[model samples]
Target: MKTSHNFKLTAAAVMLASALLTGCNQANSSTAATKADAVVAIPVEAVLTRQGQISSSYRTTATLEARAEAEVISKATGIVQKILVEEGDKVTVGQLLAVLDNERQQYSLNKEKAELSRLSSELKRMEEMYQRQLISADVFEKLKWQFDSLQASVSLAELALKETEIRAPIDGVVARRYAKVGQLVNQHATQSLFHLVSNQQLEAVVHLPEQQLAQARVGQQAMLQFAGMTPVNAELVRISPVVDASSGTVRAVLKVANAQQQLKPGMFAQVQLQFDVKTDALLLPKRALMSTDNTQTVFVIDSEHKVSRKQVHLGYQADNTVEILSGLELGEQVVIAGQSALKDEALVNVVTVRQF
Candidate 1:
């Protein structure tokens, strides 16, 4: 009877221990389930209002061109004897650029000079003889006329000799050289011996839409940017009186002083022309707005912990931000980064706040 009681007591203790362990495991599983049902935090960003400047500006691309350009061509036909200036050399007006072989021309001029001198001496002798009645007046007059004709011929020959030398007509840099030594050129030839461009001033021509023509006028300030250089000041010099019928655009020429001669012809540049300005306007990041057809909307978080889609009228956009004309007030939180994943009245947890 004592062994049976001992065995029964041991069995009861073991059963109680197993029951306690099972109840503890059930409690742990229940706690785990409760933790799993809790909502997870979603990553989001908010928009904040800040003072921003909106300058009404137009952007366009233009090509740089020299104020004056000319193609230097040969004025007379002859074989090129020498080239005085090479490419990239600075030349002034009337500076000798090239010389043609003038041996034949020089010989002709020398012969003319000799004949003119001889005729002049003969005419003087004839005039003295006629005054003294030694020869007829008609004979003396004929000699005098012959002398004058010879003198005129000599002058013409001298000018033709000078034409053998090519000279620059403008003060500029030689951009190109087309004729080489010993090459034959024709008078008034279309082939350019040198291309010269004036570097003192530069201009850029940009096209503007006809609707904006009224806003763009002469004397408007502009900013220009080119490759390998910083922004430079420019001004609206002229606007084309005629507009392109097909494109509906007008050309505007911007003049800029090139004191350093750094800007060259045919270089592309970016131009910014400001037309208007606004103050005390609500601004938001351009990315925060959504558009469909003619309806523009932005997602705003209200005080009820839900996202509300509001339609907004936009004003001027400057520096990647758009002006909020209406339908939204200052200090209202707007979703900038995650608006595509949101809907009207959707539950949201503000994870981050950022300035837009």
Candidate 2:
């Protein structure tokens, strides 16, 4: 009886041992599954590749100016009698801008004319006498000389009378009026009566670095932006071949359109010159670039929700966009944000899909 009881106790102990081992195995398997489900997916923002326009650009700042300007000065010393145009008034070339006192000039011209007429009658009589041998040759020559001198005097008098009128030298608007009515003015450079500026077209002279001298060319397109205004289009019309020794810069002139006369001279502007353009090229935001070991790289997201590092070749960069020459294709997703924490083959949770 004792042997049989011992055998039963051993059988029960073996069954309990088997149950404990099976329970431990089940608990370990459950813990492993829970840990696997907890693997983190990093959040990131990405953009799909697309075709767009890009250009290689150089940037600079300059001051706006009138393409054509002139300072109208008095040609005769006289009092300002009649003013025709005021500041902000438009005038055409050769249009009368102001008139000076003409009483003295007119009187002088009339007197000279009368003298010329008198000399002409005397010279005719002297010629007749000389032809008939009734007057000496020397006397006839003296009369002819007097007639020529009187004619020259009349011409001078006429020119002086015409100088009393001030005219517009260029087609432009009066920027300023210096001489007031009844103000005495002199015929000198310092005494400018009116300042004229043509705002139908404007210009900005920008100095480019000597390194960009090779890219500067006439007819190249550029953009100009003013303070609190819409950006305007401009073109490179002239470029100075010689470089400045002091500044290491090249002089370039840009023509800007101002048909409405909204832009003025001496206004500051920001300039961006596009030397090369690539239309229908693959473009990406400049922020998407990643610099790694002296080379440029990017983080790409595959359809499996994993990120992979890629090396890209660049073409042109402008306006915060860069051209992707190689290592990417159309319709691929590139991580633009949260890429700093990304690694190859790492699982990702796309937080946002943005446009390129």
Candidate 3:
């Protein structure tokens, strides 16, 4: 009877302990539910979508060239007497550049002039004789022809004398000089004297991909920058209709006014061909975008600081800025930096806001 009484007491005590453990579990479950309701805010950098200017352009490289250039050569064969201009001297068309040995040419011109003077007097006397019937028509005609021939010889001699002087054929700056004093140059021989280039206007020929031909047009504005220089204004002046089969490119010509003459002929330049432009465009910094699986998205923050993933359509992209085509509104807050860790409905603690 004593054993049975102890067993019954133990059973009652076990039941009380089990009931206490179950109540504790219920209280812990309520506390866990409360903890689950609290959400941590993610820190992010955001920006406001705003209206701005944007442009679409194609980039290419081209070597600059002078629009006007010439190779100065000697037209007469003679020893170079004096060099009037050195490399880098400015010259105009018809400007005397160099003198040649003209003693021989001068002597020939004087001899021809003396003979022509004598012939002129003789022709006058013969005409007077013919009028008096002292000379026949055939004889007078022969004498007149001789005078005309001598006149032609005098003109030739005068031209030969002028050819001894070298002149600039174009307005430009002398780029190179090949002739020196006492150097014998032959007109028949291909001897280069000086090279001149005009930098008032410059040209750059760029090869555009066949795909860009449709976007190219005359009078289009562009910008060009050399390796170590600031960008300058340029204009599209020409486009070749034929496409090169080997390279699959179309030839394009860009002209730039170099009134300051700061650019050179062979300098490599980066060209930005502006095909389209928008003055009032809805834009966002390119950093505000998330690219996943080839789909572009942005995390937009609502009034409650909760972020939602929005699908965005993009248009022309300029430096660091992209045009928003759809799926966004003006003045909407978007997470730019620190958005990689965000998801839909995630609470955000905005750290910084900036404008593009």
Candidate 4:
């Protein structure tokens, strides 16, 4: 009887402990289920579309050049007697650039002149003799040819003497000086006496990609920015029809009037070309853009309090806002903040929206 009672009491204690453990497990599972039903919500900002012009501008680099440039060289071989203009000197057309030793050329001119005089006197005597029937017609004709030939020689000698003095071919500033006094210049040599650039009008040479070719044309206005000078107005002067094979770019020239002569050639410059203009377009802050694998995407809040991923096509961006080309509509809510933790189809609760 005692063994029977002890067995019954031990069985009762084991059954109670098992029931307690099962109840505890059921309560824990219920608690976990309740916590899992809770929905997480994210805060975001939204924007509305409005009517305003948005410009798409492309920025490019360019170099300043003179509208007109010339390399002054000696046409005739001679020793430079004097250099009248130095580098950086402003000169006009026909101004003396350098003087060459012309003793030999001068002597040649004098000899030609004397021969021409003698030929003219002889031709006069021949004409008189022919009229008086003292000389034949053929002889007079021969003397006339001789006189004309001598006259041409005199003119050639005079031109050679004039070439001994180098002159500025254009009105410009002497940008470089290559020859000095007493230096012998060769006619066929590659060396130039001076480099002149017209500063009255400056040009900026810019390389444009194929996409920008349509927007660039002659007479279009543009803005030029240099390192030290203020922004200047420029007009498109020329454009190359062919694209460079290696670079795939087209060349464009912008003409800028340098009335003050402050702009110089070879200076670096920045060029801005404006293209499309949208009067009404949906714009979102640039910070709102989310990109993955170079594919741009954005997060939007749907009507069901769920987050959804949206792919968007963007256009010109300015003032921190990007133009939405497609995949988004006006008055749609976009996740601008707390997007890092949100996933697709996740539930959201709007805390507040940013007003812009």
| Candidate No. with top TM-score | 2
Q: List the residue pairs that clash in candidate 4.
A: 41-349
* Clash pairs (backbone) in predicted model 2: none
Candidate 4 per-residue lDDT over residues 250-295, each given as its tens digit: 9888898999998888888888865566778787877768999888
lDDT of 4: 0.84
Q: On residues 1-356, what C-alpha lDDT tens digit does candidate 1 reach at each position?
A: 99999999999999999999999999999998876543422345888765567767789999898988899887678999999988899899999999998888899999999999888888888888898999998888888888889989999889889989899989889999998999999886667889999887889998999998988879888889888899988899999999999999998999988898888889888899877777777898888889999889998887866888999999888878988889898888888877777888876778888865
Badly placed stretches (over 4 Å) of model 3 are 1-40, 129-145
- lDDT by residue (1-356, candidate 3, tens digit) is 99999999999999999999999999999998776655458889999999988988889999999999998888899999999999999899999999999999999999999999998998899899999999999999998899889999999999999999999999999999999999999999978899999999999998999998888899999999887788999999999989999999999999999999999899899899998889999999999988889889999999999999999999999879999999999999999988888889998888889867
- The models' CA-based lDDT, in order, is 0.86, 0.91, 0.92, 0.84
For each candidate in turn, the TM-score is: 0.68, 0.88, 0.85, 0.71
Best by lDDT: 3
Query: Alpha-carbon error at 109 in model 1, in Å?
Result: 6.9
TM-score for predicted model 3 compared with the true structure: 0.85
Off by over 4 Å in 4: 1-48, 131-134, 188-190, 278-283, 291-313, 325-356
* Candidate 2 lDDT tens digits, 1-356: 99999999999999999999999999999999877654658888999989998888899999998989998888788899999998999999999999999889999999999999988888888899899999999999988888888899999999888989999999999999997899988777458899999999999999999999887789999999999999999999999989999999999999999988889999999999999888899988889999978799999999899989999999898867889999999989999999898789988889999975
What is the Å distance of residue 149 in model 4 from its true position?
1.1
